[model samples]
Target: MTTEPFLAPVTTPAERREWILRLLTGTQRVDRIRRLRESIILSLLFLSALISVATTIGIIYTLSIETFHFFQRVSLIDFLTDTQWTPLFTEKHFGIWPLLTATLLVSAIAMLVALPLGLLAAIGLSEYASPRLASIVKPILEILAGVPTVVYGYFALLFVTPLLKRFIPQLEVFNALSAGLVMGIMILPLVASLSEDAMRAVPQSLREGAYALGATKLEVVWRVVVPSSLSGIVAASILAISRAIGETMIVAIAMGQVPRLTLNPLVAMETMTAYIVQVSLGDTPHGSLEYQTIFAVGTALFLITMVLNLLSYRFLQRFREVYE
Candidate 1:
């Protein structure tokens, strides 16, 4: 004879109902726990976004308040039309043109140098270079970006200026040319990396189609790849320009603090960033007009950067090519 195990069956309706409720409760509990975790993750992401927004708002507010005070003391017409920028001097003339022109000139030179070289590098990396070569070269190229601006500043002052002086005897020791050239070198990696990524994002099918039409490698790259990636390239250039515009240390060290409204790159000049740095060195007393000038300059810089970003966004939206 074998021993049999007894099992309890839910014979009563109440017992069956109780069993069903227990199973439902377990599933509901699991669902509730999942929802809670999801809510926590969502909250964290929202907080991160909020923090960024808050920081931007805070900066804008600070700039705005101080800028308002500055404008109250100095008329807008004088600020815009005045050729001299001698805020720190006893004979104060509050024209922003000198700083503005110097900023533009340096940025223009940087763009001239960086754009062509970077575009060429990007093209070579994306269309011509082997994967092994690209992998090795790209990292080495990006290493330039990691080098400090202060180091670049000293290099421009100590090395590049002296070297250029040999070729061009007219070049000033502390001039816009050396600073601009070094600044361009500093920003080249940004353009190359970004433009290469954009070029690489272009669909391979487009290149194949161009090749099928008996196009050469150069033709395919210039016509198919470059056109498709134009938005990204332009965006990268704009970003690099903004970087050059806002550059402080390199320009400050290499380009002398003489605020002059001249297009001559061989002459020493002061940029808006350089001006801000000059003021921020703690020599200017707090609550003074000299101190307030930094805020006004900052507001202008903020506006310029914001405009560039907006233009980049608009261009990307208008010209971005979508691939299936």
Candidate 2:
């Protein structure tokens, strides 16, 4: 083997320190740029979220101002206690209960149809249906939601009411039962889709554990899945109620313009939304009592919807399950 000469490495401490300082400076600059970018993105997201809050605030303020004007011309006592709602008549009555009672009746009828069918559909889709079947069926169910409310209104008026009249001869041409039934069908997808999603989110491990305990598939679904997903299921139901309450066209066309205090579902009845549509369709000039009534009714509608959502939130908080 031939011997080779060794070369000594040379580097100044000053150069070494300078290179290290440059590297640290670059890293600090990069970190600062990254932080700035992150801050900008966060700021944009916060503003985007605030937009909805601001819109809601604006609506509440507008309604409050107009409602104050309405209460000036109309007494709160009369509005609450009067049995009639002939606001446009020469002998005007503003008893809100008639409209309120009708609204509740329609909503109750709708829930009766929606809850069982929706819950069952959700359970079947989440537990029983094969993946391919669910994929096909879920979309078809949701397609009902995509249909225009106007179309549903027409169907209720032209088809459903006539069909019901055959069974119950007392049913009117325009009645709450038909509107409510179609409205329930319209809201069915909301309950089913949301509840099914909630049930599906339940861990497979829970089902496995139930099976290990010698439980049947139905038992696992009912005991393990349904109980755990109860919060979401309740939320879905509440959301459907809110939709039913807000729906205008179906009730307007099928339930008629008459506001009656009676509990019977076969008679023509008007909801708050129907009243609003009636006023909007009329030639009621701006700043008139007729115009102000819409805002007042809208305020009430807003309050009712808000209460329902709050109830949903409360129930969700109370029943929500924590899973590892």
Best by TM-score: 1
lDDT of 1: 0.91
Decoy 1 TM-score against native: 0.90
Best by lDDT: 2
TM-score for each of the candidates: 0.90, 0.86
State the lDDT of candidate 2 residue by residue for 1-324, as single tens digits. Answer: 664432222257877777779889999999999999999999999999999999999999999999999999999999989999998999899989989998999999999999999999999999999989999999999999999999999999999988988899989998999999999999999999989988888889999999999999889988999998988899889988988998999999999999889999999999999999999999999899999999999999999999998988776665555542
Query: Over 4 Å off in model 2, which ranges?
Result: 1-45, 317-321
Candidate 1: lDDT of 317?
Answer: 61
In model 2, how large is the Cα lDDT of residue 86? 93
